[model samples]
Target: MHPGVKTKEPDKMSPPEKMFPVLLQKNYVPQGEYEIVGYLKEAVKVKNAVGQMVIVEPEEFVKGEMKPHESPGVGFGPMEMKDGRKVNAKIWAGTTIKVPVAEAKYVVAKKIAERADDIAA
Candidate 1:
């Protein structure tokens, strides 16, 4: 250690990449009551049954090439304010989140059944 040298300040650290859990069942889905606790650049985070968290983009979750029946969804709905306008939730860069999945109530079942019927047809 040099006696006359001044100590340098430590650099600030950036946040780690967030991750969410993957629910791999047709009956699992995100509900419409959840809120986005954090925002990421084109990504969202969620926890799975095994306690593993993962990150995903809005397009990957909402409108990507991935089939809705195959991947999980972020359980959130359009948010309406007192101004009579609805706000759609989004994930931006550096957002932390906890995505929840609900039991596929009916629509998912109908879609699966419809697909099966289409195959038969």
Candidate 2:
């Protein structure tokens, strides 16, 4: 035993236990409760008086394509928040976020409402 280091007695330690449950079947699907981890962009299209269609307008919009993270070993990894914070949650394709079933429905509804015009068209 080293004099500089302190050691704990075996009797004082707690018994070992599993943190997560073990699955009996190998074909089990996990519940959706994850966060989206990647870059995103919000784009809007406006129609002019002459009915001209424009894709990218620098003056009125910051146009850019939505790009995802392309790093290996990032499958079902953590997601980055709008406030530049990284959350420890598994996500899919860095786009479709696997959130709670109820929350997922809410998110979809909210998005549809926000893009009502696009849907109508």
Candidate 3:
């Protein structure tokens, strides 16, 4: 083989191609099938089973379910509305949630906090 010339056979692919794992955000739920609607350097637009197009953080994987870790920490603060004063609070990963994915329609990639009652107990 010539120094400048390259001659290497490509590897054979199995029946089904392998998919890479997708990196998820703190509050993002990685589950179910996702359609590749768009692509970006940082993330890709994917449609979940609900037909909702959302941005999926780029990491790896094509269609699959994944359980992400808890979200970031958040503190509660006081806030007043026009109606009256209320005990508004900031929220972080207060609980563990299971996100299910059906088809490539919509994506459920968001962090959520557990209920106050659940945490209180």
Q: Report the Cα lDDT for residue 24, model 2.
A: 14
lDDT of 3 by residue, 39-99 (tens): 1233578999999988877555323222222345443334568889564332112222222
What RMSD, rounded to one decimal, does every model reach?
Answer: 19.0, 16.8, 20.9
TM-score each candidate.
0.20, 0.22, 0.16
lDDT string for model 1 (55-97, tens) is 6545333322222222366443456799988765432322223
Q: Summarize candidate 2's per-residue lDDT along 1-121 as a digit string, tens digits.
A: 8899988667876664322211111111224434332233444467778898665634331222213335765444446899997766432221423344454445445442111112333
Steric collisions counted per model: 15, 1, 14
lDDT scores in order: 0.37, 0.37, 0.34
Order of the predicted models by lDDT, top scorer first: 2, 1, 3
Q: RMSD in Å for candidate 2, one decimal?
A: 16.8
Off by over 4 Å in 3: 1-78, 85-88, 94-107, 111-121
Residue 8's C-alpha lDDT in candidate 2?
A: 69
Instruction: Give the per-residue Cα lDDT of candidate 2 at 70.
Output: 58
Order the numbered candidates by TM-score, best leading. 2, 1, 3
TM-score of 2: 0.22
Cα lDDT, model 3, residue 84: 95
